[model samples]
Structures are given as structure tokens and as C-alpha cells.
Target: METIAFFNLKGGVGKTTSAVNIAWHAANEGIPTLLWDLDPQGAASWLLDSKAKSKAQPKKILNGKTPIGNLVKPTNYQHLDIIPADFSIRDLEQQLQLQSEQGQRNLIAKLIEPFSENYALIILDCPPSFSLLSEQIFDTADALYLPLIPTHLSLRTFEQTRDFFKKNKLKPKRLHAFFTMVDRRRSLHRLMLAHPPKMLKNGLPTPIPYAAVVERMGDHQAPLPAFDRNAHVSKAYASLWQDIKATLSDF
Candidate 1:
């Protein structure tokens, strides 16, 4: 499976929404897709109408006490399954640290490897932070997709991600980025889009517009496309998914 993570060091950047929408699009294309919500907040799970509680603690899976297969739960959509997040995931970093010493972060990779061929794509909706758990995600993923706001601070965080990869000797394979919540009326937003940051290898061609329809995802409890396929934001996500698939081909 092509494992891609939607992540940002800073929160409120539309990471979870983008992950959910993109996974829907992938499944709609007849590709078996799995959305793994790694955020402790459980926003993705709730968005898919799944219960917020999970019987299996993600910590156990990370500690090698439970099988990763047991964590898989089918969502309402066809060919789309979710490994929902639980509150116990808040201790994921501590669990990893306790399981092994330094440089033994392959536990996540080992967990995911067995099921690599079972699905066409795996989307990880990661928590917002720079932590030990994030390091493990970097170890497990084939690509990292950062949903950033068009701002100077967001550019700084993107730089930090690049620096972390360099310091850890990780190849930035398929490192893709796109701007979320873009307000074209704002001069700063327009200027940032006009003069793209050098840190992004190939910026996604479409920017998710700042719209109330996007924010109403919580009320709909489904992907933007599922409710209104013709909505501007939904169409944007569909186009974004196409761009993402093309980038993943390079991997």
C-alpha cells in the first residue's frame, strides 16, 4: 500500500479534513483505502460517524502486545476502512519510549508491513506536533503531506520538517505540500501563493478555499464530496486527490 500521512506541526490547518476527503476520493475510485486516525482528538472518527471509543488501545499495538489487524474497523463507505483513534493514543510517545531504546523506531513499520499489500492506499491522519510519535510516523510513511496555511509561520514549520528529515538521514520521498484555508481576498494570502516558498518541492496546484462549506464538515459528519459533490470545496478536494495520486506514482 502507498502509505501517506496528512500532518502539520501546527494544528487547525485542515489536516484531518483533507485526509478524510482524500481517502473518500481514493475509495470512490475503486481503490481499497484505509484512514488511520493517529490524532488523540478522534476528530476523523467522529467525522465518519464512528463511535469515539475504541476497544483496542493503540498503545498496545505499538508495544507489540496486540495485532494490528484487530484494530481495523470498516467505515460506512465502500472500500474505506478506519483504524479509529482513542484517548490512550495520547501516551503513544511514552509507550514507544518504554518499548525500545534509541534508534529502534521501526516498531510502527513492522506493524504496518504485513498489511502493505492488502490495500491500495493508507492515509494517516496524524496529530499536530513534533514528538516521538511523529518520528515513528516518518519512519512508517512512504510520503508526508503537509497541509499548511499561507503564512510566514507555516513556512517556518515546513522548514523544521525538512531539517528534521535531514538530521535523521531520511530521504524526503514524495514530500508534498499544499495550502489550506486560503483567502484570495487577503493580500498576504494572495502574495504567498504568487511567490511560493522554496521549501516546497512541488506545491499542489489547487488551494482549498476558505469557505463555510469546508467548516461545516463536522455538522455533515461525512466527507465534503459525499454530501455535495459539486460544491466548490468538494471539487477542489477531488482535484487535489488527483494531484496526490500523480505524486505518489513517483515513489
Candidate 2:
């Protein structure tokens, strides 16, 4: 299965929202998608209306004490399943740091290997950080999707992330970014959307607009399309999903 992660070092950039929407779109297309909520906050899990059947420690899956498959819970959507995260996931970073470099890198890949036979795609909803867990995600995911807001500070963070990958000798081609929370009323946002930096020229063309509906995801506890498919924000996400599908085809 192809694994993709939605991540950003900076939070509040629509990372989890984008991951949830894309996974829902993939499942709607009958791709048999699995979304693993790796963030300790469990936002994606709650958004999808998925809950752990038992109060099992998520770290058990990491140490092999529990079968990863046992944690998989079907979401309200068809062809979509989720492995919800809880506070226990916060302990994984310390555990990963204790392993050798190779072990740290391969730990996540090994844990998700069994799902390949069932899922065509696995989406990881990652936390906002630069730690050993993030390193494992970088090594395990086939592609990493970054959500950026159209602002000077956001671009600065993007540059820092790019430098991190370069310094670490990670494959830069695996990184793909897109614009989020874009407000055309602001001249800077309009300018960036019209002519992004050369590095971001490769980003997905469709930008998710700043909308109340997008923010209401918590109130709805469902994907945009599920609650208001006709909303412009919902359509934007649909278009973004198409762009992502075409982009992943290359890999």
C-alpha cells in the first residue's frame, strides 16, 4: 500500500483536516483507505466519529505487545477505517529515541506492513513537531503532504523544513505542499496565490479558502463534503483531492 502523511512543524495549518478530507475522498473512490491518527490530540479520530473500542494503550502497538490490526476501527464511512490515537501515543517519541537509527526508521513501516494486504492507501495524521517520531514518519511515508498558509511566516517555516530535509539527505521529491486558509481579500494572500515562490510552484494549484464551514468541522464532526457538499470549501477540497490523486500517480 502507498503511505502518505499530512504534516507540518507549525500547527493550525489544516494538516489534520486535509488528511481527513483526502482519506475520505480516497475511500469514496473505493480505494480502501486507512487513516491512522498519530496525533495525541486525536482530532482526526473525533472528526471521523471513530473511537477506540477499548482503552488500549496505543504504545502497545509500537512495542509489539498488541497487534496493530486489533486497533483498526471502521469509521462511519464505507471503505474507510481508522486507528484512533489517545494520550498514550505521547510516549512513543521517548520509545523511538531509544532505538538505533535504522530501528527508529523502520519501526513505523514494520507496524503498518500487515495492512498493505487490505488497504490500497494509508494516511497518517501527524502531530506538529520535529522529533524522532517525525523522522520515522519521514522514512515510512511514500509521500509527505504539507499544508501551508499563504503568509511570510509560513514560507519561513517551509524553508526551515526544506533545509532540514537537505541537511539530513532525505529525498526532497517526496515533499509536496499546498496552500490553505487563503483569503483573497488580503493583498499578500492574493499575490502569493497568483505567483508563489519558485519552490512552491510545484504545490497543488487548488487553494482551500478561509471559510466558516471549514472551521465548523469540529461542530459537524465529519468531513466538509459529508455535511455540506455544496459549500465552496467542500468543492475546493474535492479539487485538491483530484490534484493529490494525480500527483501520487507519479510515485
Candidate 3:
């Protein structure tokens, strides 16, 4: 299975929203998809209306104490399942630190290996941090989708991610990025959309507009396309999924 992670060092950049939408779209396309909530906050889990039992934590699976498949919970959507996150993930770094260098690097890959036979795509909703957990994600994900705002600060974070990969001699199969919370009326947003950073490998041409619908995800507890498929935000996410599908030809 191909694993894709929605990650960013800076929080509040629409990472969880993007992940939920993309995973929903993937499942709508008949792909057996699993959305794995890796963030300690469990925002993605709540968004999909899925919950993990108190005893179900990623730490056990990573440490080889629990079977990955057994921890998965089916979501409300068809062809889509989820492995919800729990607060125990806050100590994930400490757990990884206790392992050997090889184990630290390969822990995530090993956890997901057994699920390859069941899922065609696995989407990871990651937390906002640059730590051992991020390193594990970098090693595990086939494609890294970075949700960035059209601002200088966001570009700086993107550069930091690239430098981290370069410094660590890591190369993910694909790196996709796109602007989120865009306002067409704003000059800066217009400028960034007109001329995106040349350094980025690929970017979705459509930008997810700043809309109340997108912000109301917590209240809706469902993906944008699930309730309001006609909304502009939903259309933007659709375009993004199409672009991503074309780029990830193997999908």
C-alpha cells in the first residue's frame, strides 16, 4: 500500500482537514483506504466521527505488542477505515528514543507493513512538530503533503522541511504542497498563487479558499464533501485530489 502523510511543523495550517478530505475522496473512488490519526490531539479521529478505545494506542503497535489490523476501526464512510489516535501518543518520542537507531527509523514502516494486503492507500494525519516522530514519518510516508498558507512564514517552514530532508539524506518518493485558507481579494494570496515557489516539486493549482464551511469541520464532524459537496471548499479539495491522483500514478 502507498502511505501518504499530511504534515507540517507549524500548526493550524489545515493539515487535518486536508487529510480527511483526501482520504474521503480516495474511498469514494473505490480505493480501500485507511486514515491513521497519528496526532496526539486526535483531531482527525473526531473529524471522521471515529474513536479509539482507551487501551488502543499506537505505542503498543509500534513496540510490537499489538497487531495493527486489530486496532483499526471502521469509519462511517464506505471503503474507509481509521486507526484513531489517543493521548498516549504524547510519549511516542520517548518510546522511540529507547529503541536502536535502526528500529527508530523503521518503526513506522514496520507497523504499516502488515496492512499492505488490506489497504490500497493509507493516509496519516500527523502532528505539528519536528521530532523523532517526524523523522519516523519522513521515513515511512511514500508522499508528504504539506498544507501551507500563502505567507512568508509558511515558506520558511517549507524550506526548513527541505533542509531537514537534505541534512538527514532522506528522500521521500513524492512531495506535494498547496496553499490553504486563501483569500482571492488579498494581494499576497494572489501573488503567491500566480507565482508559487519554484523550489516545490508539485503544488495543487486550486487553493482552498477561506470559508466558514472549512472552519466548521469540528461542528460537522465530517469531511467537507460528505455534507456539502457543492461548496467551493469541497470543489477545491476535489481538484486537489485529482491533481494528487494524477501525480501518484500508482494510486
| lDDT tens readout by residue for model 2, 13-114 | 999999999998999989999999999889999999888767676677677888888889999899999988853655776667665545444677888899
Look at candidate 3 and give me any clashing residue pairs: none
Using TM-score as the yardstick, the better of models 1 and 3 is: 3
lDDT of candidate 3 at residue 200, scale 0 to 100: 65
Pairs that clash in candidate 2: none
Candidate 3 matches the true fold with a TM-score of 0.94
Better of 2 and 3 by lDDT: 2
Model 1 stretches with alpha carbons more than 4 Å out: 52-54, 57-60, 102-105
Candidate 1, overall lDDT? 0.84
Tell me the whole-model lDDT of each prediction, alpha carbons only.
Answer: 0.84, 0.86, 0.85
- For candidate 3, the 10 contiguous residues with the lowest summed lDDT are 99-108
Q: Please, what is the TM-score per model?
A: 0.93, 0.95, 0.94
Error of model 1, residue 151, in angstroms: 0.9
lDDT of 3 at 3: 90
